[model samples]
Target: MGRIGNIINRKGKQDAKRASVFTKHARAITVAAKEGGADPEYNAALKTTIDKAKADNMPNDNIKRAIDKGAGAGGGEDYFSNTYEGYGPGGVAVIVETLTDNKNRTAGNIRYYFDKNGGNLGTTGCVGFMFDRKGQILIAAENVSEEQLMDDALEAGADDIITEEDGFEVVTAPEDFNAVRDALVEKGYEFVSADIKLIPQTTTVLDNEGQVKAMEKLIDLLEDDDDVQNVYHNWEITE
Candidate 1:
């Protein structure tokens, strides 16, 4: 490929990434508003989703349109959430959470991705039991003292803190997420990301190159789907 080809590939990837982010965020805002009503003050889920969208630098106009759509003023598209469980390469348990207006189409795409990527989509609760739901937050490891972080996180009701070379990950009970986050904010700590996540109980390490590649492709396919909100797997592999 020539230089022009590389440029086109990069642009295409960028466009796809942007479109994926926009679709996911818009659908999140719409669904959150619909479920809890359009008023953020009265709807904690909507408020949090909207804040996440804004954090990703989503346009206010787009957010407003989604709110209107959810309020039945525009778009008229109805969306619902779905989850798919499966085993990926190396028998790694995988979970895909989706927001879709067309369940049939979303199901088909998810099945196809799993099948083509050397995996099989399975029934609900198949892989779900191997995970635990927790509120997780991450902060960059730099410019912060470990002692201070440990003190603040523990005082803020975090259940545990895992320090890595790249970042500090704080885990909290689901019900304590907001309280913990607010306490950290008061201590002037900024988060890289904060979310309720399904943490795996165990992990499969894939040393085979083929298995690693297949797992990576499988994740990319699931995440690239317009309806997918999140994808989780217990594969400890590097690309």
Candidate 2:
């Protein structure tokens, strides 16, 4: 996504980008299966993970192998989730989510990135209160009217609909995520992206090029790490 303003564009090679996406999805599927059991029917989380993977066109064989690894059929390595909170240049708050097998290694690497980029890693929940966790679904705006999308989304239990530059966003409560998503799917709405995110309540604006450059470098470093699952920040860049 190359979104101007609040949304940071993810720019990279198409092939490498796709491979990274698939790897992350596979890891998520494996973890969900390992923790919740291999049967998606009995495991709501696993089912949702699979649905997300399928939406991205993840190969069936790869999905099956990940599930197998989680069930010990393919000898999967153990992994655990970790989160880090910190402040970047211009007092911009950021939260980094990670899935890792080695806590020390990941922590060291994360701290280094923050320190090297004129930032500091803070204790857990340092900036969490500044954001709201919500289920987000993004769909293309093409061939659809705003009124129509809003009506359908609200009726499906979505809390709100935000009209983005190139798409429509449906925000739902965590518990109502699956219900709203499935309902929209039934109505034949295809999504560009669907997942839970920590939306910032207030954003920090960077006026100077130096601050913007530092923020970008911090984000790029964090995202390049394989253990880092997602990075949320409060810096709002203007065009």
Candidate 3:
């Protein structure tokens, strides 16, 4: 199959990925609620954080129970979020964000994956400069005009907004995420997902083989680790 054909077929893999991604995000929400306030009304970040979870089909009971558990005694100690910087195959900068209580175990496994997969695990701040943390909001594209979308997003404190073929990517500061999400929600926008994400400052172009193989290896290593919450890389991909 050609590259585009392979990408078309990979839609199934994305569905599989959702299951793993939701599990990781669930842990993140539990941790966030524990550290901050459990009440989503008071904790704006946690509110949007859980919103993304629910957007992905996470059960309402699980969401409510996570908040209760997060506020309960002895909950925060089981999870902590951290970001690891590294260089992947072809010198691609990769950042792995994780929520794990056992930092030692997570670190050891991550380092091993990098070493074994033609990558190098760098020290803190090594490749971190390659990325910037931002608020990312995605809303359904149906019947939404770019001009109206831009106006609404900017009014909601978004730094910039781009309308994609399938949806809109609204960008904002880490602090402004909740406000943007709330504004969009009140406007009756149908959002697929809304959360804080890290965007690569720059991206590296890769061949089709490089893209598939590198992602396959990275995904395999990541899904095996219970501590990994999210992984971000600068490898530029296309259909």
Please, what are the lDDT tens digits per residue for candidate 3 over residues 38-129? 88888876777787787667788777777777888434457767889998887888889888878998999998888887788898999888
Rank by TM-score, descending?
A: 2, 1, 3
Q: Per-prediction RMSD in angstroms?
A: 5.6, 2.4, 3.5
Across 69-186, the per-residue lDDT of candidate 2 in tens digits comes to: 8888998578889999999998999999998888899999999999988899999989999999999988877787889889988998899998878778899998888888889889
Give the whole-model CA lDDT for all candidates, comma-separated. Answer: 0.84, 0.84, 0.77
Give all TM-scores, in the order shown: 0.89, 0.90, 0.85
Angstrom error at residue 51, model 3: 0.7
Q: In model 2, how large is the Cα lDDT of residue 85?
A: 98
Candidate 1 clashing pairs, residues 3+ apart or interchain: none
Off by over 4 Å in 1: 1-16
For candidate 2, the per-residue lDDT at 93 reads: 98
Which segments of candidate 2 are over 4 A away from where they belong?
Answer: 1-15
In TM-score terms, candidate 1 sits at 0.89
